[model samples]
Target chain A: MDNLNFDEPTRKELQTFIEREQAQSRYNSTVQNMTSMCWDKCVTGTPGNSFSRGEASCLANCVDRFLDASIFMTKTIQDQRARLQASQPETF
Target chain B: MASRKEAFMNTIRNEIALSNAQELLNKTNEKCYAKCITKPGTSLSGSEETCLARCMDRYMEAFSIVSRSYQTRLARERDASA
Candidate 1:
């Protein structure tokens, strides 16, 4: 509302706070997505009293391997970019 | 003015929290329904109800495990980059 004006420092602080919250929410959503995916993959049978040892390990490894894939893809893209830059001189 | 700003921030925080809860609930509903209610019946059978309960617990456990895995990976990545 019009009356909810935050001063410069307060506005900046609020911006940082919201950004942090957004980052956290993003992380949370990612985990939710991963949980659903891995649950489908690892928990094939009916839900039991507890996760089977295989299901538990699958969930853990799923997250780690997914992250590793993400990092590897990023590195691959960066390497390709470097190669492109080396191959062609920058005109603009 | 201070109280107004505080109220505004609280609203934003509450909204974010509310949406996060909503998302989790929706996902849980979808996943459990899929896993538990394979075929719709006149009503949820006793076994279906039990499966739903167990599915919910396992889903939550999976969420926590994934959360821990991601946090550890993030910390490791940060340390490596630093």
Candidate 2:
């Protein structure tokens, strides 16, 4: 194994890498979740030949739909907040 | 800690990290095999090999796509709350 010591430039690079990895920790979990979900949805074939066009579409759609769900939730919450503000009088 | 035993411990640590990567690789191989190779022939058939290759590609692609989407969602959620 190559020894990686903390020199100035190396240290800076490592710091950046660590930060990215930190962010990626959150990202990695979602990938696992999506893989599990999409595997169930798309990979129905008898594990032979290859993924059909249908399976590929299903995997892509699975990710898109999950994002759609989050977006829908955001809009719903915002609308509720707006309604509450409009109903409250003399708050200012 | 800079003794022979320390060096041995480091080797163990390195092995653990390598094994983790190996485990993922093995899992991906098994999963893609199951997805692409239905029948167990005397040898891997031509079509079975092609399917295995494609399944591996798609799996990696899906993993990356999911990673990106999840990160984007997290950023949006943070902005929304702030």
DockQ of each: 0.79, 0.21
lDDT (Cα atoms) of all candidates against the true structure = 0.88, 0.66
On TM-score, the leading prediction is 1
What C-alpha lDDT, on a 0 to 100 scale, does residue A24 get in candidate 1? Answer: 86
Error of 1 at A79 (Å): 4.1
* C-alpha RMSD by candidate, in order: 2.2, 8.1
Q: Which candidate is the best by lDDT?
A: 1
Cα lDDT of candidate 1 equals: 0.88
Q: What TM-score would chain B receive for each of the candidates shown?
A: 0.95, 0.69
What are the fnat scores of the candidates, in the order listed? 0.75, 0.29
Clashing pairs in 1: none
Candidate 1 matches the true fold with a TM-score of: 0.88
> Could you give candidate 1's per-residue lDDT for residues B1-82 as a string of tens digits?
6787788789988998899888888988998999899999999999999999999888899899999988998899899999
